[model samples]
Target chain A: MAKAHVYITYKNGVLDPQGEAVKDALSSLGFQGVGDVRVGKYIEIEVEKSAPDEIRGEVEKMCQELLANPVIEDFRVEIPNGNNNPQPPKSEA
Target chain B: MAKAHVYITYKNGVLDPQGEAVKDALSSLGFQGVGDVRVGKYIEIEVEKSAPDEIRGEVEKMCQELLANPVIEDFRVEIPNGNNNPQPPKSEA
Candidate 1:
């Protein structure tokens, strides 16, 4: 098993209404330090018997083909520990 | 400046409509291996000057206050390098 973490965000110059709304709400809630809030998507996948690189490649294809609108969104992928184990300790040490 | 990465996903037991849509789309795109898809939110914040722990605390408060609906969403925060720098190399080496 392998774990893939994916992030999808609006392309540069695109207006994110959901982010704006969250920013407004934050300000109202006394989080005065927050300036701009951009909201996107995060997805975690558990794949069976795939290498990290192969899983990442497949996930990128997934993002481009269906998960995100490549025309208006940018996406990123992270494979924790360079392996399929997702239950590893959070600390490197 | 410090960078903050926040991820918000639907709480356990909550139905994710967007996730369902993405799953359907992926199946149509020939990604037949994907079983279930759960879509959530990813937020990146650039703060002026704040310690990692302090920034994480603020971000948690922000998540609880407005960024995520605690009633239906759960969140996680990642501080890339335990510091404010986000331009570090991808590999620790």
Candidate 2:
């Protein structure tokens, strides 16, 4: 199996009201130094294994057609270690 | 400045109707081999630079207090390079 992590975010010129609200809320809550806070979609997909390039092509098509709004959003797909289960975040010191 | 990427996803066992709907849609769209699909939040925060550890502590608090729902979601904070702008995804072969 393979897993793809797709991050869909607003295009640079797009205004994100939700992100602005979150930033303002953070400032009110007294979290100083917070600059810009932008929210986006993170999608995790698992599929039967295929050639890495084939999987990438399938995911790119998925994003273009259904996963992202092409006019206002941009998506990046990362397929980590193509044949393994998703890994947990590494523990920090 | 420093940037943080926070990924928030439903805890194990929580039903993700949106994810399920996306999976069904993918199937209907004739995308074969697509298995489990989970949709989550991807948040990007830019802040004035600080010590790495201090920044991590602040981010953890942000997640606990505002960014994520403690009861239903788990978040992972990634501090990439600590003091640079967000990087574009690397080009694939």
Q: Which candidate is the best by DockQ?
A: 2
Cα lDDT for residue A87, candidate 1? 39
CAPRI class of candidate 1: acceptable
| Per-residue lDDT over A1-93 for candidate 1, one digit per residue giving the tens place of the 0 to 100 score | 677788778877899998788777777887766766788878976666377778877887777666778778877778887754433212111
DockQ of each: 0.43, 0.64
The top-ranked prediction according to lDDT is 2
Model 2 C-alpha lDDT per residue in residues B12-42, reported as the tens digit of each score? 7889999999999999999988999999999
Query: Model 2 segments beyond 4 Å from truth?
Result: A82-93, B83-93
The ten-residue window of minimal lDDT in model 1 chain A covers: A84-93
Indicate the DockQ of the complex predicted as candidate 2.
0.64
